[model samples]
Target: MSGKYIIMFKDSATPEQIQKYAQDVSSNGGAVHQVYDASIKGFSASIPDAYFQQLQSSLTDSPIAVIEPDGVVTTQ
Candidate 1:
């Protein structure tokens, strides 16, 4: 499933630190599809909810939240 996510890492984080976040997600069963980003806005690739929640407190800056392409929702 395609999704639009906003991932803002800790501004205080170093390049290695940020890269570690991405690696962590992939290692933890989260598949990062793409890091959709532009000059104006910043966002990360598509990862599972597990990945999103994992990088919460670690982010010294604003937390990254998945805005679109939400998790699989069942409608009955």
Candidate 2:
């Protein structure tokens, strides 16, 4: 089972750091969907259930800020 996630980075995170993180996610069998560098610093990715825990742990231990489910958000 794979789920989408919003991996937020610190406002001060460098582009290199973000890119590296994205690469790490891909290496872990995840797929990056979007990357925001201005105003918001983060990337949206689809991560496999198997590597989800490891991803959370890695992010928690890194300079990243937060991680949350990228649940569908629709405006009526």
Candidate 3:
């Protein structure tokens, strides 16, 4: 079950680090839509469930802040 996800890096994350992460995503049968290294240190991508765990584990002790599903926001 592949799905859209938002991968946010910590403030200490460098641009190079972010780029490497993007490369990892793309190499692992994922599609990176956007990378935010200015105002935000993160990226939005579509990752497959089969590779999600490996991706997360690869970043262990790294600068990654959070990895969560991308979803719509509603205001009512």
User: Which candidate wins on TM-score?
Assistant: 3
1-76: candidate 1 lDDT, tens digit per residue: 3233555543344556546666766686665555543432334566666655655544545433323443456999
lDDT of 2 by residue, 1-76 (tens): 7899998888778889889889987898899999987778999999888787886778656768998999879999
- Residue runs of model 1 more than 4 Å from their true location after superposition: 1-4, 33-43, 57-76
For model 2, what is the error of residue 18's alpha carbon versus the real structure, in angstroms, after optimal superposition? Answer: 0.8
Over 4 Å off, model 2: none
User: Which candidate's lDDT is highest?
Assistant: 3
lDDT (C-alpha) at residue 72 in model 1:
53
The count of residue-pair clashes in candidate 3 stands at 0
TM-score comparison, 2 vs 3, better candidate: 3
| Model 3 ranges off by over 4 Å | none
